[model samples]
Target chain A: MSTSQDFPTRKSSWKRFDVTVLYVFDLLGTFAFAVSGAIAAVRKKMDLYGILVLATVTAVGGGTIRDVLVGRVPPFIFRDITYFFVSITAGLLVFFFHKYVERRFKLLLIMDAIGLGTFTVIGISVGLKFDIGYFGAVFLGVMTATAGGMMRDVLQGEVPLVLQREIYASACIAGGLIFVCLDILNIVPDINVFISAAAVIAIRMISITKNWNLPKPKI
Target chain B: MSTSQDFPTRKSSWKRFDVTVLYVFDLLGTFAFAVSGAIAAVRKKMDLYGILVLATVTAVGGGTIRDVLVGRVPPFIFRDITYFFVSITAGLLVFFFHKYVERRFKLLLIMDAIGLGTFTVIGISVGLKFDIGYFGAVFLGVMTATAGGMMRDVLQGEVPLVLQREIYASACIAGGLIFVCLDILNIVPDINVFISAAAVIAIRMISITKNWNLPKPKI
Candidate 1:
């Protein structure tokens, strides 16, 4: 392992994205996921505490798992208070205005896609930092992008959405592959992150609009 | 943090139990949990692959989460080939003998309780080694005892049994407290672990036999 002095050199090409910028994207993704969780909670008519727990878990659960798998102790969510507040705020907003938000399902889907894209980029970057192999990195990326909503669906007594025929996790995997390829080719750091995230978002949007799905196994 | 020469002192006193003993109990617990998961998959009428997947996850899921929280990467199940084989064997057994097992639900419940007890002990010991505080240790213990079953229930599209009226998690918590207190009082390590695990098993058995339940929340 290299010392802090060698940290910059050791970091991948995606490292150039400023921490502040990454933090902002993280919060945006968190908020979007939290709202998705809150909407599910409302549909179940869960109490306030249940809604908040679901929202918080949906926002940070995947990242927590990612951090743990990469041997990062005391996950980022514990270190930063902002993530907690953002998730709670999103939950509160949805709780108070769920009927209005419910009518704007397309808007929610768009926000979720944005969250998925950004989270995939973040997961890839973090996984690369841990120096896990490309396959492990891509697996982590897909896990980060999909685990939260999958958890939410499971908690609500349904098969995970990711496990069903959907382009959701596939989009994240696509973004991860793009990021890994770009980094390997020594692309500019900011461009690598942007292109990867954009790819995920674009794919998600296109799939939703086109009603795209992976072929299902016929029993 | 210590050198290999100081490894023994760094290890908890509970480490006196040889790897063989620990491995045996771990495999036993894994088998029990795997059978439980297979039963759930059978109820859902999932395919053979789904049944195996559910069984594998249910056998190792709680321990995986516990390991992650303590910054132990590449969980114990991955290191031990026996755990994997035990779980798969159990799942296959259930797949073939599900009707017989279903008719003997009491036996299945007993096996599950044994798994729960042993897992709680393992979680507490690992958490303490990580120096996470007694509260966190107990929480980990309860989580380790319950989370796999909870995940299985959720994956099968049901409210988690732990979340409903059952003395399941409470027994684990109680056992954790006992272990912590005994350790603080300088009790012999092996005895402490035995007592703690036995307490959990006893409590769980009594609860089942007595029809004990925690009061449900008023909806």
Candidate 2:
């Protein structure tokens, strides 16, 4: 079968596959966030330009903030431009077919959960590439997962759900911590990514199904 | 009087004086923004930590974003740390004596006007150092003047005043455009700064006194 001779080529191909998967997940996450943002803008009765602005910001805002903090100039979206197009496409789709999209609320939540997990891992990976410590990496992860939603709420003149009583950011934090711990233990990078992302997705899904929430201050 | 020989020395000393005055104005602006943020946080019944966070963000957020966009790593505040101390001091004072500060609201508004003008000119100067062009410079100028207040308002779960009917951002835009025009005419840098800042302060003050507002959408 020539298994020994093909080992190096197979390993390289596997690496490429892993990268491709991460990239796909990142785009999916952007689309989901953009859709949510467009929905919010529509609910606010904002004009078409406003809807597009909100969607683009909600999709790329967190990552942009993360990149700026980690000293990445111009941000990744500025360079690639695909994220901008994806967000615009999502916004337009929702603007035209909002009722249909709203009918699939359950599906949207699932997609959002997937996005949160993927974004957290991506943020942590980026942070770890810098001199920021593990704590900073985890912070970047949680910020990447939640900041976009916060920006959306803030733009709409509402307190952020994450700051109020959502289990959303907590799930991201847990997943980020797990990723860091596994990385510290010298786990395989690919396996570590899968396990951490899965953990976040699981936590988020369970919380949604169980109607879980973080405790609110009794002011 | 040896006027010819003294001309070069006077010019150099005048340059130093201009820089020092700008630095002082920057600090004053930071202090003013921090006090405003602290006031907002108190109104929202946020805790001490929340007050501190809001104050710091209000004072530095615009400058930090500007630095990041211009590819400055770690940001100027991180390196100097003076801005941090200035914000903390302002926050602490407001937390303790907010009633007194509130009573002197007119003085606060004047200080804020000065800050708006200074920040706008500073942002434009920074942007001009990059390859982002004249329009980008003006945009950065307006952004630097208004973004901190926007952040403050957003954190308090309110629509940003700059984005509302306020004439605040318009004043900044005018000041920025004036700065660009004067620079293009080869006006002296010091005189350009003074004229641009005066234009902003005048526009803001006149608007306040006349209770001016931008027209609202009739939707």
Candidate 3:
């Protein structure tokens, strides 16, 4: 636990292209998070209010926690009404058509991937926004991608997988690094977001499918 | 719907007291909260990490949210170590002795009442700390008493009750008023905390047992 005095070093990067990519990825990641939230609520036999809370947390929980961590005031939820509106609409749709959607939707898997990837990139972007170095970006990226789930679990009275499952947040960390690399190469920001998101989603899917996991810390 | 201007009016409470009893009630309230969190985990078949998260959130979620609302940075989890230790110990005890405890423990019922009551008082205390005024104090009080449960639900992917379930929160509002009245009379702060806590606990128990509840809002 090094204090702020020993801020981690980051590679010199961040051309204009990187920023543009981040913006695109951010939206995709948010939408994916919303989908995941909706699915969780639908599975839980929750009423409308429950669905709404789940959707809101899935979409914004990550950033809300991140904002608090970075000393940003009130976080992004209060910044715009669009975010909330999007989550609510998503929740309503999930509530009304959950059974049919769950059976038919292949998009959920894609959304999960995109969400993992995009959120990782967004977290790194937040790190850059606050002038944090590379390591900070990686840390924030993981936090951003997983904090929503952590919060979602807390709200649902479950333990967050982030603390127990090794690979859960590792995907985001990997994607964040890719984002840093893309920026250094002066790639378009939107492209950077896509690439980073892809990396996380793929890695996560592969890890899960292959039963890859980190060793648990011994007591 | 009310904007920033409403915030000042909301917080305009002037009930004065020594502000010490608040501490005693707050401690008892925290303990009760811890019990609730741990019990929920037991009910849900959550793993150890789940138990830890639940215990922590139940103990501190209300206060943390209140602090955030008042623009107090880092909240109580960061402010002191006592809460962390207490929550963990409570969680471990619940996990290890849940079966024996479940048979013998009327503790949950009593603890829940105390938790609700203490939380109601604490909420107003936070409002007063911020000098948010009368309406604000009660509003905050309700939020404080219930936000942890809301968080608890969200984590389990359940819908939060705070946005609905008028009766539970309204009791807190009433409790805030009771505390404010005592404050205006310049009651001893410790006594004020106890009285206010008592009012909330008693109200919760009576209301729940007798099926007392606020009128449902027309959707």
Q: Residue by residue across B38-153, what tens digits does model 3's lDDT show?
A: 77787888999998899889788877877775667667677666777777887888889867656655566666677777767666666665666655576567767887877676
Per-prediction DockQ scores? 0.16, 0.16, 0.12
Q: Estimate every model's Cα lDDT from 0 to 1.
A: 0.75, 0.78, 0.67
Query: What docking class should model 2 receive?
Result: incorrect
TM-score of chain B of 1: 0.89
Task: State which docking tier applies to candidate 1.
Answer: incorrect
Global CA lDDT computed for model 3: 0.67
Q: Candidate 1: lDDT over CA atoms?
A: 0.75
True lDDT of residue B164, candidate 1:
48
How far in Å is the alpha carbon of A127 misplaced in model 2? 11
Clashing pairs in 1: none
User: Please, what are the lDDT tens digits per residue for candidate 1 over residues B1-219?
Assistant: 111111113345556454345455656778888998998899899989888988988988898878777777667766666667887898888889888877888777787888888888788777677776676677677777777887898788786666445678778878998998998998765567678888998999999999887543232
Model 3 regions lying over 4 Å from their true place: A1-28, A46-49, A150-171, A186-191, A198-219, B1-14, B17-59, B65-71, B74-143, B147-219
lDDT of 2 by residue, B40-92 (tens): 99999998888998998888888887777778666777777788998899889
